[model samples]
Every structure is written in C-alpha cells, then in structure tokens.
Target: MPYASLSEYNFFEGELKNLQPVYKVIPYDINSSLFTDYAIKKRFIWMPKDVQANYTTDREVPVFPIGTVLIKNFYYDNTIPNNTTYIIETRLMIKKADGWAFANYVWNDEQTEALLSTQRETIRMSWNQNGTAITTNYKTPSTIDCATCHTINNVYTPIGVKPQNLNKMYTYNDGTKNQLSKWIEEDYLDTKPTTINSTVDWADASQSLELRVRSYLDINCAHCHSTGTSCDYTPMELSFSQSTVPENLGICREPIDFVTGDQQYIVSGQDIQGSLMHFRMNTNIQSEMMPPVGRTIVHQEGVELIEEWINSVETTCP
Candidate 1:
C-alpha cells in the first residue's frame, strides 16, 4: 500500500477507510502535539507484504523495514464533544532504503484536501476553544524543517515510536487493549518483551506531577538533548528513563549558551519567576525559546505544568 509519492493517495479525503484497516492506528502517552491544536492522531503502516516489524527486548526503538509508512494528522476542534473540526495538516514518514524520509501536507480551506508543499507557510486560523476566542498562525513546516527534529545521531529516526512510549493501552473498534499486545496479535509487531517499561500518561491524574513533567520533557526535548545529538555538549539528559539525579536533569544548573536573564537558568529548588526553564517555556522568541520550531503559539498548559513542578521542588547546584 506504499505510494510512489505522497500525492498518490488522497489521504485527506475519505481514503482513511481504506488505509485505517490496513495500517495500525497507534497512540502515545504524553501527546507531544503543539498547543492550541486539539487531538493529534497517528497510524503506522508497513508496506512489505507478510513482513512484520521485529520487536526490541533491549529497550531500543524497533526499526521497521524499508517502505514503512507513519502517518499523523493534526486538527483543531471547537467545543466540548466537538462536532466540527478544522483539519490543520498531515505528516508522513516513509522508511526508504537510505533512511527515513519526511513530508508534510497542508490541508485546504475546504478541509476536504491537503496539498504537499516544499516551503513553510503559516495559515492564520481562528477557533472558539473552551469558550474563548483563539487565533493562531498554524505552521506548516518545510521539507527541510522536518529533518531538524527527526534526525538523531546524524540519522533520521522516528521519535516516540519506541517501546516505552507505545507500551500502553489503546482503544480500538473492538475494545481497549495494550498496544504492544495488540500489535503482536495483529502481526504488526513480530514480538515484544514479556515485561515492558511504560512512560507516564500525562493526562492521567493518578500519576505524580513529577512523572508527568518528566515524561513531557522526555518526548518533547530529549530529541536534541540526548547524547550525540545537537545538544549533546550540554549535561542535561531529558530522556524519560534517565536517573532522577539533579545534575543529569539540569536542576540548579547554569545556562549552557550564556542566556543570562534576571534569574538562574533552572533554579533547582525555586519558583517559576527565578527558574530559567520557566522563562524559556513561556516565550516563543528565538534564542530564548525551546523547541525552536513547529510552534508559533506558547503552550500555556504545558508551561503551567512545568512551572508548578519547578515550584514544588527544592534543589541547589551545590
């Protein structure tokens, strides 16, 4: 079911009926979607007939054979139990012989179609979210911008497709079931570990605030912060599985790029006002903001969550 080009399939139309049954619709725990954007859905499809993906018992991400296709759709919804939604964009990740290739399609004004574009563009959109009038410069990233976050260790890889992130339960048409087990049962995954470590479900109130915050940072920032990546020179390790030690997690640490504001970069045991992490997360200004791309609006909810977490802890670099 692989297409020679992204335009070959009319996925933005009603073609989902054909693809949904063939592809494995997957979900992640933390939900790394941009703020102001409601509900992001993902599906993974393998092109090779009768070839299932090999599962990893070593905790590394399972590598799919060439021709694997990963699809993600973004939408903006207006009200409770939203009856109407505006399609924002759709992104596709294809595994080629050389490596993974990326493409992004911006949905049309009619919402019935999406067009593949080579240049990044912004679509000014408006919606009534939670009874509040909201407007955003919905960003459609260029082909090159797609590589910035996907590339790891000089290789393009799919983030959040790892076992730990995908080890939770997912609700299908049949019923709710563990995603790993479902994948194995459906023959999408060859095999999986008997016992798998799981990342936190950020929206679940039962989990600790610390766990939720860490999970958020792991999926959202670890791409560049991990060893050998763009931010490798820094000491911070935002990986979810990393040790909870202060130094490893950047508590009470000084800014790496000499970003001296009125407060310390990450005041280990301080409130939002003095925490540099809080400052950076609160703004979208280049050189001051994190995740430098894919977002034109600040994620207020995420910023508030991190702010609360930072204020709850007390740590010192010394």
Candidate 2:
C-alpha cells in the first residue's frame, strides 16, 4: 500500500523544504534531461540495505532490487522580490515484487508537505526567466499519463539512471566524484565497466551539432520512439545507439503520417521548411507538438538547435 503523505517515508532530513536526503538516500543527476517547462528538478535514489543494483548495459537501466525507490522533486525559483521557491511535485517510482509502481505527491501551498495524488491538476504559475516574466499553466500528469511514456514491452521502466547518462562527475557533500563511482562507493551499484559510452549535456554548445541533437532526442523522444515502446511503430529510432544510422534519424525518409503544410520528409536534409521533425519541435499546438504532454510552450532553444542541425545536413532526398 502507498503512503498517504510523502513525509511518511522519511526520505529527507530535518525540514522537508530543504530537500536534504537522509543517510542512505543518495542524490544524483543525469547528463541530458527532458524539459518540463524549465522546472528545476532534484533526484535521489534509495535501495534496500546490502542489496546493490546490477549493471545490464551502458544504455539500459540497472536492475534494481525490490524496495528500491527513485525520487524526483520538481520546483521553480521565483525571481520576484521575495525570491521565494515553489515546489510543485515529487514523483516516486518504487521497485516492487511484480514491477515498478508510480506514486506522485503534490506539494501544498504552505511548502510543508506533499500528499500522494493520482488526480491531474493545472498550476498557473509565473516566474522571472532572464529578465522576462513568464507565466504558464503547468500540468501535473496522473498515474496513467506517467505510465504512457514509462512503459516498455508492457513493463514500467525508468528512462534515466542508465550508465551512459550517469557517467559524469557530480559534487557531493564529501567532494566531486563520478556518479557511477559514487554509487559503487555507497554499495548501491555493482560492476563498473572500464568503458562507458556516455551521453553529453545537450545544452552544451561546445559539443558537435550531431552529438547535441542526438543527446537531446535520446532523452526527450527515445523513451517512446525506441523499440517496444509507445511510438515504435514509427520508422524513426531516436535512441543514441540506434540514431547513428541516417535512416533511423529519418534523414531522407518519408513520414508515415502527414503533419501539415509541405513537410514531406521526417527530416528533410538542409531544408528546415520541408522537415516534419522541425515543424513538430517548433510548434506549441496541442495536436502538433512532439512529446505532446510535457510542455505547454515551445522549447525555443531546443527548436533552434534542431533547426541548426537540419540546416547542416548535407544529404538531399531523391
């Protein structure tokens, strides 16, 4: 049975507002992350004592033991005069004997405690972003919505926590160390391979255009687009490993379904105007946006990145 309140788990120490993890609940972060209307996220993982997760593959999620809990908290920093912060939600995925289970906790206005809720909600919020006041109605997804993107081959699975995404260094209370190494140190993970095909930070412009775009799609679209998932029927495979093939990226391939206008190919090389992928990313229309549920507004920076990448493609479809 799920706990009625998040506080019942005792995952945090002292004041819950501070988000300090208790003893064995280890904090972590991924390299490339999905965008959720620019909400800041804090992630942590806790597992049963003496039981460590087994490594499957660099690109796949580790095999966690039963009773493991993956926690993620979403919030926004208000840039107003008071500089107040508002925590929106905390989502937990617990590994059970059967499979993984979802538990979403909606924070209260007092910022004191969050209660488990399966109901969908819209939170109208405003915040300052780079000197601009931005307002949005952030949608909190229900458990059903959570399963939509998380299910693979009819089984609920995690998107992040893969070795490729967690191979980078992170600063802990002790000092800075590689996250995978930190996991080993805490006895939360077993088996550290010599080589890891790591994922790069998508927002880092210093990386190659291909690397940045591939990393972005791997995190944002691959969860549903890869094999045995939601959009597997589509020809495009956006996972970093599969995306290496031009055909998988849909460079010159025709889209299975028409999206609108003269967008003929899923990704029309060197033609942003004729690319369906670019069209979907650049729009905020409910019926047209890619990843449909995550954001209400367009990811302008991500769109720009895709546009730049599309323009750099040298191949032309026959």
Candidate 3:
C-alpha cells in the first residue's frame, strides 16, 4: 500500500512492511539498472483505492494515476557466515499533484532503516557469487540523476513499466502468477490490450540473436539514443522496433566524431574489435562509454552476445 501523503511517514526507515501489503512486484525481461554488483528487486505500491494504471499498445509504457508509487531495492548477500541479504538503498517514485517525484533512501549500517538522501554515495561492497570474490563501489544515483533517463518526452516517466517488459510470469509466495493478468485481477491496472509485444530474453540462447541484441540495446541505450535526446546528435536510433532503419541500427554506420578501431565502421560485421558499438560497450571510461554513467564495469556477457550477433549477420561493412 502507498502512504497517503508523501510527507506522512519516513520511507527511509523501511516503513513499507508495517504500513500495508505490497501492491505488485514487477520484474523486467531485461532491466536497465544502475551499475552495481548486487541483485536488485522492484515492487509497485499505490494509495488504497487510487486509480489504476492504464495499458497501451505499440511499445508504450503504462500510464499510472496520481498517488501511484514504485519501489526498487538494491541488495546483495553478506559474505559473512550467515550470508544475510543487505539492502543498500531503496528508491521510490510517487505520483504527486505536480507529477512523479523521485527520492532515494540509503540504508543505514544497522540495516533496520534507510535515510532519505539527495546526494549520491559510493558504498564499497564485496560479495561471493558462485565462490568468486567480487568487489566494487555500488554507486547510488542522486535524486536529480534519477530523472536523467526517466524523463521521457519531457516527463519523468517510469521506463520499464511497459506492457512488453512486464509480460512475463513471476513466482510469488502464493503461487506463480502472470504479472499482467494478476495486475488486472487485482484492479491495479486497467484496459488489457489485444496484443502485447514482448521483447526477447537476451540470455536465452534459443532466442533469435538479432532480436536478443536489439532488445538489449533498446533497454540499455534507446532511452538516450531515441529522437530529440542528446545522443540523437548521432545518427544511431537504438530503439528496437519494426520501423527502425538499418542504418540507425548501426549497420555500416560510422561514428560522427571518434574513429572506431582502425576503421570507420560503427558496427563492422564479424569484427568485434573494429565495431564502434562493441568498442564503446566494452569500455568503462567516462567519456568513451555508450552509457556515460551508472556503470563502472563492462557487461562482458552482453558484449559477447552482441558480438556473436554481429558476426553472424554480416561479414563486412562498406
């Protein structure tokens, strides 16, 4: 349940568990999150009896009413003997009278509460995943930085709440439930579209490589790369859809300012080293990376997948 007033309670204190039940826990097929080494969990909450979100077709994100709230928690397992999960921060999106308001609460040392913070913090974090010791600074996005990608068409919209992204099934305490269907039954969402276009599960090797790579790019880069954004200064249109042009997809396209490898090809087929797309994605440098911020390390698996797709599609770029 959502708090009646944005000022009513201290969200930084982990008040969600005591106030009301969870509205919904929505997971994405592929999520574009802030660069961190930990697993993330997301949930939706709304003021009781508030208007439900409206559905749409053709790859549009769902529209939520005033008083709606979205919550996301970033956490990781403690490497100590008990291996307890520790939450680093919790982000909230509340639909106020003015529109969506963004806030972040940083968890305290005790883990019992998090405090509202306006500035970004770098938490030196370490974890053992499959017995591999991994460590990194978990960067928390400042409240202002939250709007950088979330602001679409001049509005602070939730990026991943689209029909296509939320079309998957989830396992819950009661049972397995299809998110969209459950949303409808709970009256948390309205107007089911006849057709919901779901993107590819990028890690699934059985799916089409083209669809997988394009879908990955859509979430990871399309927000800034779409028309009218600063990235649009370049010719690339990374949004994955039927109408997207081949050149926009970086087929034989060339970077405007910087040289790609030893050649000019933005995506030199079968040549990952020569492709600017691969080069930028594989880098963590502040100025040269495709995503200028929010990530400190390259997503090696994602780069490999895109490289495989590029290798299979074309032999050369002219």
Which runs in model 1 stand beyond 4 Å of their true positions? 1-7, 10-39, 42-44, 57-59, 79-83
Report the C-alpha lDDT of model 1 over 47-117, residue by residue, as the tens digit: 45566778764346787887777777677667224446666777788788898888777777655456677
Across residues 56-168, which tens digit of lDDT does each residue of candidate 2 receive? 89999999999999999999897345568999999999999999999999999898999999988898878887677888999988999899999999999999889999999
lDDT-best of 1 and 2: 2
Best by TM-score: 2
Residue range 1-318, candidate 3, lDDT tens digits: 233333344432245432233334333233333334445554545544746888767477677878777766777776544577667777788787788888787877666566777788998777777786667777888876787877777778776667776777866556787777777876778867767667766777888777777778877787777775546777688776631466777778877857434657777777777788888888877678767766667777788887887788664676
The window of 10 residues in a row where model 1 has the poorest summed lDDT is 27-36
Give the TM-score of each candidate: 0.88, 0.98, 0.86
What lDDT does candidate 3 reach at residue 305? Answer: 81
**If ranked by TM-score, best first, what sequence of candidates would result?**
2, 1, 3
Worst 10 residues of 3 by lDDT: 26-35
Collision pairs in model 1: 269-314, 269-315
- For candidate 1, the lDDT comes to 0.68
The list of candidate 3 runs beyond 4 A from truth reads: 1-35, 78-82, 242-244, 257-263
Error (Å) of candidate 1 at residue 257 is 1.5
